[model samples]
Target: MVSIEMIVAARARLRGHARRTPLLSSPFLDEIAGRRLFIKAECLQHTGSFKFRGGWSAVSALEPEVRARGVIAFSSGNHAQGVALAARLHGVPSVIIMPDDAPKLKISNTRALGAEVVLYDRAKEDRDAIGARLSEERRLTLIKPFDEPQVIAGQGTTGLEIAEQAEEEGVSSAEVLAPCGGGGLTSGIALALEARTPGFRVRPCEPEGFDDTTRSLASGRIERNATLSGSICDAIITPQPGNITFPILKRLAGPGIVVTDEEALRAMALAFTRLKIVVEPGGAVALAAALFHGEQLQEDAAIVVTSGGNVDDEMFARALALRG
Candidate 1:
């Protein structure tokens, strides 16, 4: 399990490396939601996602000799770029295993960040087996996307920041919503808020079809998504929540929030138009919940953590076309 102490230490390591993205607000958004709305623009973080914090935390926590041997991670896109760039910054080699159908921008960005990119068929090949083979062959450290303690601890730093930011914004209480995949970010934030701000609660947000985390929370056990590759919110789509992360979420997180793919796109469009922040569909899920699912929320103020902004130009154009 991830502890607040671990999160604090991760923040110390990330002080110079990771960005402290701002907490932003728009009156227009507040009016639409009929409550105060704040956006934690993590999309502006390094590698255009919050995954960089976890990447740096895990890589930096490794022993010098071990880290020098390099690192490996399997991600659809966001985590791949994060680990790739973190490895590059540490002067270590990185091997990224990605789905062949992952966004072109993410694949190219990972390569440009100086990692060896290996493509696999998401529908047929097993990414874990491939990662295992390559890690053994190259003596590379495998960074599990969400299950690792260091990664979860690193992600918790965002919650710490939110706590402080909320205090600064005079928000004594609010529901903090974050896009959920394997529950790393959601659980990490939950742990942080569990200690830092008892009044605040963490909520996991997801697209309608890939609501495994949401269902898992309600059922008190892990649940798997029927299909993983069907949503435009692919960044937050996972087979199920992580063993380490699910337990944390079950203990500390509030009920999960589900939004439609179209709702996510509309949130992205609103973010672009109102805040001028480009958000990917998966990244917009939390904001979508805050905006469109107000009836499900229980606070006068809502804080949304926009997870990533790594969408392709064409996909971004499609989001903007919604204009909702």
Candidate 2:
């Protein structure tokens, strides 16, 4: 289990490495949500996603000799780039296994960041098998996206920032919503808030078809999505809640919220026009839930973590078209 102590240590490791992203608000967005909405603009995070924190935590925590050997990760896009960049900064070799259909920008960016990129089919290929084989062959460390304790601790640092920022903003209580994939960020934030601000609860938000976390939380068990590749919000789509993250999420999180792809895209449009922040569809789901699913919430204010802004140009243009 991830504790506040571990999170503090991770923060220590990240002192100069991670950016303490801001908590932003707009009266216009507040009006739409019928509550004060604070946006934790992690879209502005390094590699344009919060994954960098986890990547850095995992890479930096490794034994120096082991780390020098290299690291490997499997991601759709954001995690790929996050791990790629973190490894580069640490002067370690990284091999990233990404789905072939991930955003072109993300694939290109990971390669550009100085990692070996390997592509695989999402539906047929087992990324775990491939990663295991690669790790064995190359003597590389595997940074499991959401399941590693150090990675969770790193992501929990985001919660620590939210707690401080909310205090600074005079927000004693608010629901913190984060886009959920395998539940790393949501569970991490939940654990952090559990210690820092009991009044602040974390909720996992997901795209409609890929609402496995939402369903799993309601049922008190892990739930699997029927398919993984159809959503426009690809970043948060996962086969199921992670084994390690589910227990934390089930223990600490509030009822999950589900949003549609259209809502995500509209939220993206709103972020661009109103907040002047570029948000990818997956990153916008939490804001989508905060704005469009208010009846499901009880808080007077909501803090939304826009997790990433790594959308492809064509998809971003589609979101921009929804601005009206």
RMSD of each: 0.8, 0.8
User: In model 2, how large is the Cα lDDT of residue 109?
Assistant: 98
The lDDT values for all models are 0.94, 0.94
Query: Residue 122: error of model 2 in Å?
Result: 1.5
lDDT tens readout by residue for model 2, 1-324: 778899999999999999999999999999999999999999999999999999999999999999999999999989888899999999999999999999999999999999999999987999999999999999999999999999999999999999999999999999999999999899889989999999898999999989999999999999899988789998888899999999999888969999999999999999988899999999999999999999999989999999999998899899888764
Task: Write down the TM-score for model 1.
Answer: 0.99
Clashing pairs in 2: none
Worst 10 residues of 1 by lDDT: 315-324
Clashes of 2: 0
Give the distance in Å from residue 86's predicted Cα in candidate 2 to where it truly belongs.
0.8
**Residue 218, model 2, lDDT:** 93
As a whole number from 0 to 100, the lDDT of residue 42 in candidate 1 is 92
Candidate 1 structure lDDT? 0.94
